[model samples]
Target chain A: MNITLAQARQVVAGALAAGRAASYKPLTVVVLDSGGHVVAVEREDGASTKRFEIAHAKAHGAVALGLGSRALMARAEQQPYFIAAVTQTVGALVPVPGGVLVRDADGGLLGAVGVTGDTSDHDELAALAGIEAAGLVGQPD
Target chain B: MNITLAQARQVVAGALAAGRAASYKPLTVVVLDSGGHVVAVEREDGASTKRFEIAHAKAHGAVALGLGSRALMARAEQQPYFIAAVTQTVGALVPVPGGVLVRDADGGLLGAVGVTGDTSDHDELAALAGIEAAGLVGQPD
Candidate 1:
């Protein structure tokens, strides 16, 4: 399933809107194409400056591995040695939560999204809103 | 203008929690001190592998310039030549929106937070939430 840049941008916009409505705080959002290239980005005022890179990295990890950051974190816990080795081999493997895979209506891989700040759960919530806005399905809770 | 490691951890944890509650795919959150040093990090399940680096880069940009990533993006657009030169000078510079700066109640710089995955706007929201949870103010929204 091809993920259109337009859809990704919509998702990001929706997520930001949701955050604002909830008064959750400023946020940084990122969208990546299926190929892991950055499609769009947004950084709210009052947000930290590093959020852009962090969001991209998280999205990149999801798109590259076809898995969420949470799963990677679990794997790291189960196999610290392997995770460490992989970390060394792959200079950019971040086993953190907040990265999610974007799937089309038919469950085909479309792209990925990453968010940071607030709680992981909150970040996830904003992402979920964005995915829904994009007419995509996120992994089950 | 000093950011403590404890504050960094708090920001990350809060961001992670927010993401989880929202049922986002997964994520990685990171906090950096004013000096652009990593103070805390967390990776959740299903998050992307590259989030670590992205987070670092985003936060680095915020701290380095004392501006939000979105502002930086504007600058990049207005002066692509200068941005290109800056990127070349700083190998890790990514002038995208998603990073935010953290400040104290008195408006003193504390550090920055970077997030990845969903969208730049979403990432910024999560970071803002984390900063608020840490009892600090994000820059003016």
Candidate 2:
């Protein structure tokens, strides 16, 4: 269930190409290893300076929690206390949109990828394309 | 080194509860499993829809890379191409603030969580609370 840096790089490259094909604005992307370690990272031109932070935060959340950011949103609605405690304990977590989990063909977690720049949905699409290019599977909602 | 769904739920609940005590605005919280999969999620009332996406992306990036979103942000400043490529690959990834990694007492990989709505600092505080509530250690950048 380990992920190679080369594979992560390929995934990011594929995703970037897809974003370009869709005429998306500048963006930032990141990949993390199975141990929740950074394998590769990139930021597009014209992306907001803060986007780097945003992208990392979202990606970090996915790998740390092993779930999409959207799912977290639903939980927050039901319980505010738990969410607050988590925020206080984990300084890096941001429960927003635009992050996805990365898994291997055998359903093993290889890592995760996150994108920022355009809408969350658009970002998810670009990530999906990148995962597909890498011959991997993106978790379905 | 696998995080269970039950653990993820506990972390989210704890964090949200902490936020409410502080009377913070609405928030979005997310938790990821050890394999970087979605385990649990929640969004507080008044939180923008985008918060959910941003929070998850940030957390995903943090755990995937084994670094805090803050560090990832700094790296992005130095490496734009890499970041851009990452955004292209992972649609849900955003390298912003508010993501954290969840680790067990033995420093084993547990999971990650992300929160949004308030300031990045506040969001992080909530995430920390969640991790602690789950009886796990939240990596401090």
Candidate 3:
């Protein structure tokens, strides 16, 4: 399944909203389709220039491996070699939290959402909230 | 040693033939010379968009490291950090089973082949088959 640009934009908005509510730092969010192609991305004011890459990579890795970044983080710890090789294979992969897989009600993969700027846990919370705002499911593990 | 244009074409043909014979998914093939320059590439219909980059990286890594991707996979298991560092330095390396180095009769390096679309084992099989069709030896270990 593919994520519509409108939905991606909504996800971004929701993430930003959640960030603001939590008084988190400036955030960057990236949404990518199942093919790992970016659909929408945004960097809030004060976010570093590298935030985009970091966000995109987190989302890209989630879609590329069909697993959330949180799961990847666990795998990275248990099997560092496999995760490292996969990071190279996928071109960009950050084995950390904040990269969540977006799914439909049927559990079908739609896309991925990546959030950066705040702590990894906060980023992940924002991403999940965003996915919820889009009426979608967020799989962080 | 150099792999001639004709030989490269032959390799592509053989790889495609093998894929078709096995009724595998649409495939992408990349042939690279010893210097890691692309000599030939083909993407079958319905292949995913990222197949080219994935295939190229596999082949490029094989030739760049002077070892088949399968061997790289093993090395990655033993030395995760080292492999990750090398991947970063090389800029493109996928330590997977689809990359195979091509060699001449006297064990002189000719080039490398990368295949994607099916399982990694199947991809490597196609690459080896292609090398053989070109009358070259395949070093996949």
Candidate 4:
């Protein structure tokens, strides 16, 4: 499955709009394709300088592992060394709550979206909004 | 002066627009702070898997050296071993023409932008466009 550039834009805009609508701080959002490559990214005004990088890392980790970063975060707690190895393998993987896998209606993996520069819960919520806005399923668990 | 996240997004958007306008193949654009850290990145759909890495390498080389990758290319010709060492020194410094130094109106270094997925000349042009669109200067040399 592929994410068109237009859809990628919608994901970024949707994420930003969700953050704004929720009254959260400015955020950065990123989308990665199935192969764990960036498709699009954006940082809202006043987002921290590192927000974009964090967002990308979270998305990369999720898509590369075929699981949401929240799952990774939980696994990391059980096996720190294994998680570190996974991070090394993925080269920017972040086992955190803000990354969610993007899947099609048929449950085929499309990609992932990540959000940063706010509370982890808020970040996850915005990412879900982004994925849904693009007509994709976001696994929030 | 510090480069704001908002301006970083501008650079990313401008670079992608330049690539589209030039009809270059799908591209990946990246921005790095002077400290060799990611600010923003984007890879167009259908772009090669390595485009984002190559783009980031070029940008890191430019920001770290305080010169365009074109200059680094020329320097590399005179000292091949040194350039290779430089590449190792910088995590992802590709001594090629795709990277351009970013500067402010007062000539203060801000960061750099790199473009991949096209000819070196075309990549340089896109990176320059990104810098210029953000009202930042790109030192092509």
- lDDT value, residue B95 of candidate 2: 66
Cα-based lDDT at residue B17, candidate 2: 93
Q: How many pairs of residues collide in model 4?
A: 0
Error of 2 at A44 (Å): 35
Q: Best candidate per DockQ, number?
A: 4
TM-score for each candidate, following the candidate numbering: 0.53, 0.51, 0.71, 0.89
Off by over 4 Å in 1: B1-105, B108-141
Write down the worst ten-residue block by lDDT for model 4 chain A. A41-50
Among all candidates shown, the one with the greatest lDDT: 3
* Number of backbone-clashing residue pairs for each candidate, in the order shown: 116, 146, 0, 0
Order of the predicted models by DockQ, top scorer first: 4, 3, 2, 1
Instruction: Give the TM-score of candidate 4 (chain A).
Output: 0.95
Using TM-score, rank the candidates from best to worst.
4, 3, 1, 2
Q: How accurate locally is residue B56 in candidate 2, as Cα lDDT from 0 to 100?
A: 81
Give the alpha carbon lDDT tens digit for every residue of B1-141 in model 4: 556767887888898899899899988888877666666777887788778889888888888878889998999999989889977876678888889888899999888888999899999998889888999988977
Q: Tens digits of per-residue lDDT for model 3 on B46-109?
A: 5655678788888988999999999988888888677789988986777778999999999999
Candidate 4, pairs of clashing residues: none
What's the CA error at residue A96 for candidate 2, in Å?
36
> Model 4: which docking level applies?
medium
User: Rank order by lDDT, top first?
Assistant: 3, 4, 2, 1
List, for all models, the DockQ compared with the true complex.
Answer: 0.06, 0.11, 0.26, 0.49
What does candidate 4's lDDT look like per residue over A4-81, in tens digits? Answer: 767888888888889889899988888888887777777665666678779988888888878899998988999989
Residue B82 C-alpha lDDT in model 4: 88
TM-score of 2: 0.51
Error of 3 at A49 (Å): 8.3
